[model samples]
Target: MSLKLGIHTGPQDLSMEELLRVWRRADEAGFHWASVWDHFYANPLNLREDPCFEGVASMAALAGATSNMRVGCLVFCALFRNPSLLAKAAVTIDHLSGGRAEIGIGAGWFEEEFREFGYDFPPLGQRFEQLEETLQIVRSLWRDPVTNFEGKYYRLPGAVGSPKPLNPNMRLWVGGNGPRRTPRLAAQYADGYNVPYQPPEVIRERLDALEQACERLGRDPAEIGTSVNLRFHMRAHAGDSDADPPDNYVPGSITGTAQQAIDRIGEYVETGVGGLNIAFRPPINWDAYEAFIEDVLPVFHTASA
Candidate 1:
């Protein structure tokens, strides 16, 4: 499939109604999907970020608001909830949105959120172990008749499903960057992989690793979706700053000119990205929304390998 373009929204905002306007505008702009961040506190992207709203709540609200839009979390913090319960919650949202939900999840990182919220922030290895179990349990729970799972981290006794996915299998997207475990989990359960704001070179390495994992597992890497989360826009000096992004941000994250920005995305596409999720932090900077919607996005859509 050719590349698709989408944007991210912060859940640490005022209310769903407030963010709903952004979603409606994105929908009106002819975008394919709307992704919201699932951070409990302000994330690394925020220059001086603060946690605003809850992730799943905004997801449920977004699912209810838009009819044509496909809504999902950019990457949910998976450590806070039980896998079976999280699966049920996703299933409920899927039913509410009439099957428009896609589960976007990751092994939780943000240490601040865990310490502040009183959740265990385990060592990296243990977290990956939990994430693996979570993905497995979610897949099992989505079965037509329901199933059982007894893993080191999760134990569901003949768990009955909540709302069976309308799509024979609910779409799963695992997000992260563990050279070994992450891609293996993706190969086993993910319909797609959601990568964070890593540089193209790093992204290429990660993709290679995933391909290796897929090969080991007898999976065709091409069959699994690959989506990159472009950290920030590169419109110009005076572009949107709804988000005060960081400097170490990747090349795609807020440094290039319009043409350069387009070129960078093209490079990523060439490197095997199936879709691009460009970040549009607002306050509407020097860059005009008209120019972006009218000029830039169209160029991205028509861009070919």
Candidate 2:
């Protein structure tokens, strides 16, 4: 499959109008996918007062705003909402986008959000249990006519998920960078797998684990699409204040000149990932973003074609 280019952004510290503009611009610029992160507060969690939009609602607006790109959240914390409810929301967004919607679920890590929001911050292993049950429930609801499931974290009795997704092949993604269990769970349950902010070598290692997991499960590794999300810190010009990345800068970010950014993305492509998403944080650099659309995207898209 050809490599797909996408955008991932959080709905924090930006107005709804600005967010829609970004998504619409991505659509017009020929991005293959556009996604939002599921978080109650702005990530890297500097302040509790920062305005952040809810994920499900943001996803619906994303579907309504963009016509071409597949819209998604990567991902929703499994413990935050009932699995069945989240599945229904995904189906609704799929229809809203004319059958272009995907949803990703993960065992959430942001403990501050959990504790402050009054959610029980259980141990990691237990959270993964919730995640596993959530995936089973969601998949059944989306694909089955009548769903009946009984798991440790949740139970559904003869439930019907009406008005199934507009597209039967609508994807469900598993997102995380966990070395073992994440990939295994993804091989068993997800149509796609995503790891965010990891360098190419780390990504390659994770993909290898995924392949091994698929082999052990007697499944084809090709069954799951894979992607990585790179932080976007490209510079528009020499003097741009935000040109310098933060002190706690993530490795494998897309930074520097357009050519340099292209080179960085090439490294990820060489790892055999099917897609790469440039993650945008608020206080966006419009010039830098446009430079990417004009100078960088064409290089990879042309190569893929």
Candidate 3:
């Protein structure tokens, strides 16, 4: 399979105009996908004063700004919105992007955001239950003419979702770093599975688990796409030895020279992921990003071709 390259930008610590510029640049540079993240607060939770845009609105802006690449949010927190509302929003975004919108959902983790925002921060198990219920409701709403779901957390009775997605096969993704339940959930419900900020070994293990889950469920493993998200911190030039990634940099980050970035991406391809998204946080290294668009992307695109 051809490996797709993408950019995953968190909608925090950046202006709307800057975000749109990045998205438009990725689109023009032939990226296959572009995605935003969902969070009520800027991650690492350093301060409450940080500027963070909401996910759904940012996604709508992304759809309006980009013409080529697919637009999506990496994962919308299931606890924040009703399933019916999310489903309708996804369909509307699909229409806005002319059938280039995908959606991902997950059990949320930001407890501070939940509590501070007046949302009940349930235990992990309960959150997972809610997430599963949300998945079922969203699928039914998108596929079935009328959705009627009776779950412990949510009840949808005879809900009709009009103006179905512009793309009949618009993908729904399940994203997390969990090993067992996440894979099982993806096998049962999602069209795609995504793991973020994970090393190659961990990603391979997760993918293997997903395959096993698919086998146990008697479903085709190939039916669900797999992807990994890595932190991007590329150096501007090949000789910039001192310009290393931060000491506290997360695992699976792409750093160093253009050639090194290419090789690291190759390792992910070997893990059997169909796509890789480099997560961009501010202040973005524009020079490194341009070098990636100019030097690194072509190598993979040409090889895939």
Best by lDDT: 2
Each candidate's TM vs. the true structure?
0.88, 0.96, 0.97
lDDT of 2: 0.91
Runs with alpha carbons beyond 4 Å of true place in candidate 3: 241-243, 302-305
By TM-score, how accurate is candidate 1? 0.88
Model 3 pairs in collision: none
Candidates in order: C-alpha RMSD to true structure: 3.5, 1.9, 1.7
Best-matching candidate per TM-score: 3
For model 2, residues 176-289, the per-residue Cα lDDT tens digits are 989999999999999999999999999999999999999999999898989999989999764566768766479969888888888899898899998999999878889999
Pull out the clashing pairs in model 1: 12-52, 12-53, 238-286, 239-285, 239-286, 239-287, 240-285, 242-281, 242-282
- Candidate 1 stretches with Cα past 4 Å from truth are 13-18, 45-51, 236-248, 252-254, 282-289, 302-305
Cα lDDT tens digits, model 1, 1-305, are 25677767766534556578777776777666778877767555354355477878888988887876677887776788888788888888888988878877798888877887788889988988888888888888887476778788878888888668776656789987666778888988888887877778878888998999999989999888888877664554344453344444555463445665666777787888877776655433434444455655777562311
Q: Assess each prediction's global lDDT (C-alpha) against the native.
A: 0.73, 0.91, 0.90
Q: Which ten residues in a row have the lowest lDDT in candidate 2?
A: 296-305
**Which ten contiguous residues of candidate 1 have the minimum total lDDT?**
282-291
